[model samples]
Structure formats: structure tokens, C-alpha cells
Target: MISRMLVKMIAVLWVGIAAGWLNPAVSYSEEASEKVLKLHSGLYYTIQKGDTLWDLSERFFDSPWVWPDLWQKNSQITNPHRLYPGEQIRLFSREETQTMVVESRPEPEVAVEPQEPPYYFYPPINSVGFIKERPVRPSGAIFKVKGNKAMISYGDLVYIRPIGRPTFTPGDRFTIYRVLEPLKDGEIKADVGIQHCILGLVEITEGHPKFAMGRIVQSRQTIELNDLLMPYEARSPKITLTQSKKRLEGKIIASEGHERIFGDQAVVFIDKGRQDGVRVGQSYYIYEQEKERLDSKKKEDLLLSPVDYGDILILHTEETTATALITRAEKTVRPGARIRSPF
Candidate 1:
């Protein structure tokens, strides 16, 4: 009787193991269901498996780059990087009292205070293009690319050669860029400056007397062979809004991506810069020139008053030009659009 019972138990255990192995989908479902407990609902999110600040920000706020705003909005979360399952994340706050009910029990009333708005604007400093008044004096050039590819991006390795002197060292960083063309003012029909489009960033991993090897750390666009390298200067994206004291006006000379028409959140270039008292973080109004046709011998023309249609915020400034981002617009903003300070 004891031997018969032992044999029966062994048969049951073997059957269970075989079932689990044969039905792989069932095993996968059980593993997947263990990760998540609940989903987000009504101004609150119950943290689940694979939930991150970036993902939550992108899901709720419509942008992954605005994760800092999400972190600033929540006061209960201690660490921005680490989130545990079953934890609570406040999506946003309201001025009124918040009531939470759980498991048929009512929790205490929590009053949420209104927070002040942010004054500084964060722009993508490295990805935007700028107008250079003079020719670019490159530090080096990317001669060869690794991994049998012509175009490279983030984390790709490339060999660089110095232009005049070899001053590259391990851990040295450089900005990769390429000259697009000479930006010319459409109104004046003259060349304003050279336009340089930022490609990516690289850091030296191995340095030699004549040549150095580096890996691409950050890429805004595709990095190609013979891309010019410049000394990288780390700049903060945060720029405080400042009231302009001078009444300045300029015309949009060009825009990023060379698009003929661009609107909100698009990066553009203006003819005004530091020489014209243009500073970063200053806001400008975009205006459209109004014209009227006169019926003369050959149908003469008359210029009317300009009308404001949009707003632009300055991001970076050169000697004679400035890079700006369109903040608000109700009409089409394009090249030759006028820009004036708000005073």
C-alpha cells in the first residue's frame, strides 16, 4: 500500500511539470499578471511594473522631455528615478480638497495648495541651429567611422584627426556640425551669415599624437564622415525670462529645417542679435506686414501697418543673429515675418 501511494504522488508531480512546460502561454500570462496591480484613474496613478517618470510624463503630459515638470508637480514622491509597485503618483493638483476612498473606507481630507508657475524656459540648446557671422574654425574632422557604416548616430565610434595641433585627450568632448549654406536676408537680398546645423556630440576615448578615437555620446542628427568638430561648451537649457528695456525690431531671416512655413514650437532665426541688444529669454511679438494695392498707371502698391500674430522666445544669440522658438501663434509664421520686443 505504501509503494502504491508513493508511485501515485510521483505521477501527479510529473504531470504538473509536463503541463507547465507544454503550455508556455499560460506560464507567460502568470508572469505578466504578477507585474501590474492597478492602472491610473482620475488624477492619480497607481504605480505598476515598468512605470517610470519619463513614461508617466509622456503618457499624462504629452511629452517625455517634460519629466522635470512632473517631478516638480508631485511632492509625495521622494525619488524621481525609483518607483515601487503599489505606490501612488499624483497626476496633478487642484485647489480644492481631495478625498480618496479605498477598500470601503474613507481617508482623511487632503488640501492641495496651488503652486506658482515656472518663469524660466527650457530649450533644446544642442539641437537648434545658429547663424555664424564668420567662417567656422573647426578643431578637427571625423575621418573614419567604425562598424562599416557611413552615417553614424549615438554611441557609434569614429576616428578623428586634428586640424593644426594635436591637443585631444581622453574624455575630451566636441560638438559635431556641418555648414548648410550662407543665410541671406530676403528683404535686403544680401548674405547675413553662415548657417551651421548641429549634428551630434562626441567624446574622445583613445587619443594619439596624430589621430584620436571617440564615441558619439549624443546625436541630434546623423553624424557623417568629414563632419567638422568644435570644442563643446556645456550650457544650461534654462533661461530666465527678462523684460527688454530697448525697443528692438528685426525680421526672421531663416528657420530650422529650412521649412518655408513654421509655427508654434518651431525654432527660427532672426536678424537681430547681441549687437542689436537682443538677449536670450526675451520674448518678441511676430507681426505680418499688411499691404494695399493702389490703382495708378501700373497699379502701384502701398505698405500698411504690421499686425501682430504670434510670439517668439529667444534661445541663443550670436553676434549678429539670434535663434528663437515660436511660443504662441494664431496665424502662419514664416520667413520675412517681423519681430519686435514687447517693451
Candidate 2:
């Protein structure tokens, strides 16, 4: 009977061991560890309401400007301007996972207004040039063109390299331009800054840390090899007509194309700008002074009253210079023409 009891006890112990193996209890620590591993492996995050790429970039990268980099990394974003809630954004990864899903929508094409506004609108005036006190230091340059072409135009792909080894990423835009000889004051013959003629607009499509590929989206002039690049700034098409509040006087230093004589609708550069209380949409009168007959008796010349011949509308302004469009010209306008407040 004792031998029977021993065999029965051994069988009971075997059954208990099998039960434990079949149904093991999971520890709290093991479950927590599994969750952490899953999070690290994917680094996926869900978009919440009122969340923006700018806010997210600042939260993760400590800078709001880093939003563009974040946007470029996520290939799923069709419109960088809008984001939908419940979309998953990958926080980190060189290779995006297949499970990642996002809303697919076609980006709307930006329509370029071919007609120039007669009075109140300026179509993409940023493509118009500006004057600086000094030559613009280039941020980058077009190094090569795809298909081994000599000239680049709209939709042409090219390679660009950043100067000073600064980092540039895809989706970044730059204004392509070329420098002409230094502009000079028509009266004093003083040297102004070099003229920057806008060639085109280029958007970086893909790139390395130092160099990248870009495509020309708009061409105002012929884009050539080694064309300089600078940060692109958006121009507003709507302009309001405003009367000048200050009695400011300045001279027309130059005109677009360096033309000596131009008329209505011509782009001209003046020596007065923001520092002198000049502003966009302000109107100024172009005039020339006549000599009086009192100077005929004496060898000395006597100045007569000023004669107004044209009207100019300010389009853009620099620190000490401005770009103006000739709104009306009774007589042909030329460099060295005097511009002053209408009052």
C-alpha cells in the first residue's frame, strides 16, 4: 500500500508541473517591457486635434523652423499646409514602414496670373529685382544641369551646391539670379549695390546634406550655369494706393534693363526707401526743373519752378532704395529724373 501511495504522489507532481508549463503567469515588468519595445521599434505617433507640424517640430526638435524638415521626411504629406487628425507620423526612420498610412490627396497647382493688374495687383513681383547697399552674398549656385544642357528653363532639373557648407533640404525654394555691374546714382555718380536680375525660381526636390537636386518652376529670364541662389520670399499680388505722408525727395538711380529712357509701366529704382519713410503703394511725381530768363542776363543760372511729367507707384523697398512702377508718364521718364511727394 505504501508503494502504491508513492506512485500516486509522483503522478500528482507530474500533473502539476504540466499545468504550470501550459498556463504561465505574465509578470507586470514583462508586459511593460514589451510595450516599450514596440514603441521604440516603430516610433509612430498619431496626430491629435489642433496639432501642427510647426508645433510638433518645436516639441521634438526644439525649433518651429524645423517644420519643413519634418514635412520633407514624411513622403505621405501631400499638402504641407494641411494635416488631418488620426494620421500617423513616423518620428524617426530612414526607411518608412509599409504599415504607415496617410490621407492621399492631389496637391493643387499654383496658378500664375499672366495678366498684370492695371492698378492694384502685382503678379509675383518678387521675381522683380531689388537693390542692396552691397552685393548679395550667394547662398548656393547651380553647378550642373541634367541632360547636359547649357541653359535651364522651367521644369529643368539641375544640381546645386551650398556655399559655406550649410545644410539645405528638399522642399526648400531659392530665387535664382545673376549679378550685373554695379548701379550708380544718375546725378552724383556714386556707386550703389550690384544689380540682381531674377532669372527663375528653383525648388529643391531631393538632396544630400551639402548638395541637392532642384527643378526650375518659373523662369523670368534665361537661367544659366552658376546662377546664384538666395532664399525665396513670397510677394503679395494685391497693392493698395496710398498717398505719401512725408515730403521726401529722391532721384531715379536706374531702370530695369538699365534703359536710359522708359515710359509708363516701366520698373525703376529710386534712392529713397524705408529708411526715408518710403513705402509700397505710395505715389510720387517725377519732374524736371526749368531755367529762368533771369539767368540769361547774368552768367549765373537761375532755377525756375519744377515741371511734373509722370507718376510712379512704389512696388518694393529696400533699406535705402526702392522699386517703383511708372503708373503714368506724360513725357518719357529717364534716369536722374527727380521724384518727390505729390503734396
Candidate 3:
């Protein structure tokens, strides 16, 4: 009897070893297989001003046509054309896994439904022209005021009054402009009175052919009737096109104090506009005019050396002027600084 029991015990031990039930390494491997798996497979993007779904899709997915699907899946955006800046987008994996457990309870009957195979569709490989269906105007247009004497104080009620034949309706948005002095011979001269300050934004509360009323939501100073207002219109700012694009030059017409939120904001009246191929969201470097330096050893010796002051990010564009936000500043940027496209 003892011999027979020993033989049975040995057989049971061998079976456990062969099945990997008695080995810690085998047990660990199985445990690892059962655990959930994750992957770093997503992109995080921060939306910038004037960025469109089509532009973003073209940048990331290699196709702008796929923008509609991405917008539908990722955002609560009803209109694919409109996208706000400062919004965050995260793309994550969709795969998931579940584990099964056994118990003594009676099994319940379950029904299984057949699933159809997914259809595959490929987007076109060619680059498609991105044209606006309607010309994009400034958000607040008809209610803008125009004049050099508009006194804009902080916390003042601002409005955009339409002038001449009305091109905008009620509830339409427009942009406001502070009148700036003209550039002379590719040089911008800073005159205290000519430097226009952004008072605030206004919305059209009422509309008419000759004028419109708007409520001011923001202002750097108190707004008065003397301040000139330009209503936001969708039309591209006017520009004069030259035969040679390489010979074009950038001009700064006005300068404002540094913004607490945007760091610094500068008003540039470029010779180029929509007609000249100047588009919104274009970036330019602000180069301070080369200081005229004289050698101490020889008073007659003069040197023209260019200094880089900062960079400007274009925000709004008009036929005559473009508003830009300063991104990097080594020193205060003055009027007449040269702005060039980045290489």
C-alpha cells in the first residue's frame, strides 16, 4: 500500500511541473499576459489664433479633406469652419480589453448579433485649394467709428456706428481701428498723437443704412466720440500689387503699449495687403533699424548695423494696416522697425 501511494504522489508532482503550475516564472508570465496593456499613442495640440480645421488636418493627417470627420469625433463644434484659439485637442487610442471570470451560479442564455465589416474609404492624395465661400470680414463691422479725436478711456461704453451705405446687418461682428499716421518713405515715425490705442470691442445692437450702434466689451482706456472706429468686415484689406514680390517692403505705422495678456501689441501698416498676398496668421520678424554708429578714432567713419528687437505675430489684417502681437522682445520695439518674413 505504501509503495502504491508514493508512486501516485510522484505522478501528480510531475504533471504539475509539466503544466507550469509549480514554476514561479511560468506563473508570472501568465499574470503579465492577463494584465491590461496601454500605449502612448496620442497627440496633444494647442489651437492658435486663425487656425481652421482644414489647416490643422492638413498639418497632422496629411490631408485637409479628413477634417470633417476629425471635427465630428473630437469636438462639440457644430460648424467645421469656426475654431477658437487656446482650445486643447487630445487624440487617444480607442482599443479596450475585458477579462472573464467563472462562478458556480447558473449560466444565463445570451444572444449574439452578427456585425458587418467596416467599409474602407481613402481620402484624395492631391492638395486641394482652400477657398473661403464668403469673404471673411472683421467680426464687428458696421458699428465702427472713425475719427482722430475719439477719446477712449478705460471702462467706457463703446459702439460701432455704420457710415454711408450699410454693408452689415444687426448682430454682425466687426473690427475697430485706431487711426494711425501714414508711413513716409518706408519709415514709420512715432508721433504721440498718431499712435492709436485699442479702446475695446463692440457689438452691433441696432443697424441702419447710415449708422449702427454697438456695445463696447473691452477697452484699454475710456472711449469718447473722438476715437475713430472701423467696423469689422469680411472683405480683405485693400493692397497694391507690384510686379516683383521680392522687392516688397514692410512698414510699421503705429505702436501701442505692451499688453498684459499678449505681452506687446504693435500696429503695422504694410504696403502689402490681401491683394499683395499678405494673409492673416502670417509671422514676421521685427528688426530694429540699424543704429548709425560713428567710430571714436575717426569721427567721419559711420557703420550701419541692424539690430533684432523682437518678433511680431499678425492678428488682424486690413487693406491698409495689420495688427500684430509681439511674441519675443529683447528691447522695446519702436516705430519704423523693419518686419521681414522668416526664412
Candidate 4:
């Protein structure tokens, strides 16, 4: 009887140890099985004094309008335009996730206009030769600090000197013509054509003067300037028509690297250009597509909506594509993304 009891106790002890070992192995295997998913992630930074949504987006995502997508995902945010201190934002992955819970509130609805598709026009790249001209002196001259006062006031005939720069050889000759108006209160204001002009070029001259200066020769009948020697030139006018609305898309071709112009603002480059209807001042929206949950259920219940990551504005455009200053950014604008017209 004693031997049988001891055997039974030993057998029970062995069984307990085996069970403990198996349970731990199973638990560890289950825990390790959890998979990590990588998706595009964005962070919401709180607004502080002297902060605009434009700059904030650039700081966080490298684009400004990216706030819209963030706003779209976080329905808890009642107001999109204004943000309060200590607000929380949810970061979503490319994989589907739970829909954000927003309180039942009647939100104002706005209609989104359909944007026109972009048209591509390829202009032959050609090198042309033209004569360089020298600027003539105007009748009168004005003295003001460079940034303090308008360098060339509206309707003021000023001589532009190409100070021996590589682009402007010593003997290059160019002509200057007066535009629509004269300088006002020391500032020039005029609408020349596609570009708004304030001061008119009266002449182009070679060689830089010790002190850069401009003189107004022919002022409107009532216009008068201090008795200063001015520049002179014959006036010729030309009119150009502005292009209508158009759309274009392209990827980032290059970058100007990083710069801190105003606080943390930066500028970057793209691959689209004038051939694609991109001009000097055209605006575009930068976007990166993200996979999101879609409400597949055929019921009148809340569902997931397809969304994108971020957006930005274009500053300068070229023929194939143009370089854009990151006006607004949500997340970091990376290479190999799509930039399209917002409209």
C-alpha cells in the first residue's frame, strides 16, 4: 500500500510539471503570433500663439491642407477651422481600423466642386538669341532705403543696371518702356498684363553704379518728384492674355533640400512643367493615397470613408512640372507621391 501511494504521488507530480511547461510554451507562442502592421501615420500638433494652420501642417506633415484629412478622420473635432489646446488626435494606419466615434451633432454641409482634369502641352525646348540692351536715365530721381521704400514706384521710369553679372555682360544693351501708371507716394502701382507692375523700366544699362539709383523722367502732368536726375527711355507696350483654368499632375522630380525661410517653412521641387500646362503661379494639391476601411454593409448605419494623407500648394511651376513651396503639409511629403490640381 505504501509503495503504491508513493508511486501515485510521483506520477501526479510529473503530470503537473509537464502541464506547466506546455502552458507557458503555448502562451508565449500565442503572444509572439501578434503581427505588427505598418501604415502611413500622421501626428496632430497643438496650435500655439503665432501659429497658422499652414505653418503647422508644414511642421508636422510637410504640407498644410493635410489638416482636412486629419479633420475628416477625427469626427470628434466639431470645428475644423479652429482648434483648442490639449486636443487629442488619432493616428490611423494604412490597414483598416475602427471608425472614429463622434458625438451626434448636426454639422454644416458644404458642396465640393468637381475639379477639371489636367491637360498636357509639350512645348519644344529651343534656345534663342536676343540682343541685350542698356537702360537709359529717367528725368527725376528718388532716394529711399531698399526695403523701406518701393525701389521703383508706379509709373516711375527707372533704369535697370545689369551690374557686370555673368548674365549681363558689360556691353549688353536692353530697352526700358513705361507701363500703365506712375509711382504713388514713392511707390509704383500698375497692372501691366499677366503680372501686376508698379514701376516701369525706362532703360537697361551695363555696369553697376556705386550707389544703385532710379530717376523718374516723364511723370503724369500732375506728378512731381524731388529735383533728382532720372532715367530715360522710349515707351513700348505689349499685351498678353492670361491662360484659363487647367489641371496637371506630376511626381516630385527633385528637391531644393531643406530651408527655414519663415520659422520652419521649406521649399521643394517637382517633375511637372510648362509642357503640362504648369505656369509660374499655378496652384496644386499634393496627395498620398491611403487604404482605409469602407462601409460595405448595405444599411443606414455609420460606415468608413476612403481618405488620403496630406496636401500642399505650388509656388513656382515649370514646363514639365514646377518647384513648389510647401505652403501646407500634414505629414512629411516624401518622394514618389502624386501632386494634382486642387480644383
Best by TM-score: 1
Q: Candidate 3 residues 32-84, lDDT tens each?
A: 22322222322234456777889666543446786876664442343567766
**What TM-score, over all chains together, does every model reach?**
0.66, 0.63, 0.37, 0.26
The runs of at least 3 residues in candidate 4 whose Cα sits more than 4 Å from the true structure, single-residue gaps closed, are 1-247, 258-264, 291-309
Worst 10 residues of 4 by lDDT: 123-132
Better of 2 and 4 by TM-score: 2
**Deviation of model 1 at 269, angstroms:** 0.6
C-alpha lDDT (0 to 100) for residue 289 of candidate 1: 76
Clashes of each: 0, 0, 40, 52
The model with the greater TM-score, 3 or 4, is 3
State candidate 4's TM-score.
0.26
Evaluated at residue 264, the lDDT of candidate 3 is 49
Q: Write the per-residue lDDT of candidate 1 for residues 85-148, one digit (tens) a residue.
A: 7554544322111221112244577798686444554535656778988868999999998887
Clashes of 3: 40
